[model samples]
Target: MGFILLINFTQQGDSDDPQSAAVEQFVIGENKVILTMNIDQQVTIERAGQGWRLLPAQRLSNQLIEQMMRTWQQVQGQVLDIEIDRSQQSGLFISMVLADQPNIQLFTLYLLAEQVVVHNHQLDRYFSLPLPMFNQLIPTGLLINQS
Candidate 1:
């Protein structure tokens, strides 16, 4: 059976600018959230009071993390046809957990030859992200030690 999911987002401030609209969709308050990604391997980052810390003693450079968060906050993408096949190998899987929320939002992304396909389980919809933005956000070495 096929299921349909609808995305509910509110336009904050300027609706004409896609960046501002994208930023409004995800609001990470006080850094009270955990971001995890699994591509070739799994790496997780959690709020460390004022900053972010990687798991298992890996130190992610503050600058790199900040840049990634900025990209995520301003990411712009378009929804593709919902009938696309999802049986291909998933290239990336990301999940976010809010400190005050009980549910974990998950996104599965497939890196195709021409486009990046993202499946947002929370919204039950698929989106095609810009290649540049996808490259910025999905670097395999971003979770490594920077020191």
Candidate 2:
């Protein structure tokens, strides 16, 4: 039961210098498709055999699929230290299944009227992203009652 800390560092442009690009690092719940997918309040995409499909069999264009997958795969957020009760918070729950992992990574997204934050309960870490981006992150028209 040891865990490896995963870090993602993307170099910008064609420069070999690391400083040229901004580095964004976050944990992959044991440094890990995501062998599977993320389960949200209204979104659910899972990989079966060699293909991926949307839950309840929703018809999504290939382009939209690619866009969503890309966003989830490369999703990065600024880590924050905050305390909140999971039971009391009215937030969206996202469960991420990583490759070759027996456990499911649990997360909660608190979409406040003013700000949006994702809490990783496993790591006790909170992440904040631009409110506008959150809308784009989940994709519009995907949720039935999303505002």
TM-score of each: 0.62, 0.69
Report the Cα lDDT for residue 104, model 2.
84
Off by over 4 Å in 1: 1-41, 143-147
lDDT of each: 0.58, 0.66
Per-residue CA lDDT of model 1 for 40-142, tens digit only, reads 3467766666766765544556877767755654555665546455564645667777556687767776767777767767667676775665656765465
- Enumerate residue pairs that collide in model 2: none
Winner by TM-score: 2
lDDT of 2 by residue, 110-142 (tens): 876766787877888787766875765577666
In the order shown, the candidates' Cα RMSDs to the true structure are 10.0, 9.7
